[model samples]
Target chain A: AQTVTQSQPEMSVQEAETVTLSCTYDTSESDYYLFWYKQPPSRQMILVIRQEAYKQQNATENRFSVNFQKAAKSFSLKISDSQLGDAAMYFCAYIPNFGNEKLTFGTGTRLTIIP
Target chain B: DVKVTQSSRYLVKRTGEKVFLECVQDMDHENMFWYRQDPGLGLRLIYFSYDVKMKEKGDIPEGYSVSREKKERFSLILESASTNQTSMYLCASSLVTGGWYNEQFFGPGTRLTVL
Candidate 1:
């Protein structure tokens, strides 16, 4: 079955520190896309970053980056200089290159930034 | 900026009652999706529409149906809301593209309670 797995259900980081959330997906399709989404307490989920499978360079936002290992089907998100406002449930998702446009998301990892 | 809005942020209904969750996007997107977010199970897709009047089943569509009569509007319906159907429902929309990324914008989720 095609699925995404987030190994860490909960994680904590000191304010201004850094943390990484791990994700792995099982799929046989060669063309796909990976994404990290942040859901705040307000229940608004926003896209943090996106990674295309064909791109050798990893995707990076302002302070959010991804460590994508296509061979192992692992795509992890790294949050640098974490802030208290960054505390939220982070989800890892996958979508194929086709137009079906279905996104498979992993069980989220709740990150708590301690002050 | 892309904006996705849901009709409700919180809803309460009795079992066996019908429930309708509406979503609208302002970006003229071609795809809309409905997903239920659970504590440990993650976000499970219930339905999606690639265009007006066209819909497809997602990973979990047993208790749900969808309508996309207008290009900017998509609605998810629960024929008979059950106790097991109580969860956070999220609506998202994305533009149609052929490349590796088609970023989806999400609305504030609706937390439904079946009592």
Candidate 2:
């Protein structure tokens, strides 16, 4: 069984600033995929970024980026130039290379963007 | 754009009532999932289907059943709704051509309150 943990239950960042949400997981597999998802007030979950465990290069999507440390079992999401739209419940999720690709998600971090 | 839609955005039911939640995907995805989200608990998968008429139990499947008779639609059923089951239910779809590594498209969640 695998599990993801988000130690920070809440995080706040001023508009145009930067913030990072921490995540860590327990997995014995060497190859897998990691993802960061955002759930807004609309209750729609959107993919923020993704990283392949084999790829050392971090994944960046516009203002959203991820620092994936496979050895440390850590995958953190970074938001730069944060905007009001970034305010949401951010979740760190992943699926191993086996099974039905069931996603294991962290407890989630509530991000608040202050103007 | 990949679109996933849930039949209801909010539902209120009584204990011991039978509940059905419908989900439809327009992206022709081969994999569909049902998850329940609770505050500070993240999302816990209840069931998933990789093909029509085929389903697998996820982390939590107690008192729940699913149907995937058609490729574009998946349904979750709570045989006997309970107050403990009051939570947000989400539906997601993803392509499984090679594997389940693709990003999942989520629907606007159905918030079910069992009174």
DockQ of each: 0.70, 0.62
On a 0 to 1 TM-score scale, where does candidate 1 land against the true structure? 0.96
TM-score result, candidate 2: 0.97
Q: What is the lDDT of residue B76 in candidate 1?
A: 98
lDDT of 2 by residue, B69-91 (tens): 99999999999999999999999
Residues B9-84 of candidate 1 have per-residue lDDT tens digits of: 9999999999999999999999899999999999998998998999999889998999999999999999999999
Q: Runs in model 2 with CA error above 4 Å? A: B97-101
Per-candidate TM-score against the hidden true structure: 0.96, 0.97
TM-score of chain A of 2: 0.96
The 0-to-1 C-alpha lDDT of every candidate, in the order given, reads 0.92, 0.92
Per-residue lDDT over A1-115 for candidate 2, one digit per residue giving the tens place of the 0 to 100 score: 7899999999999999999999999998887889899999876999988888888999999988998888899999999999998999999998876656678899999999999
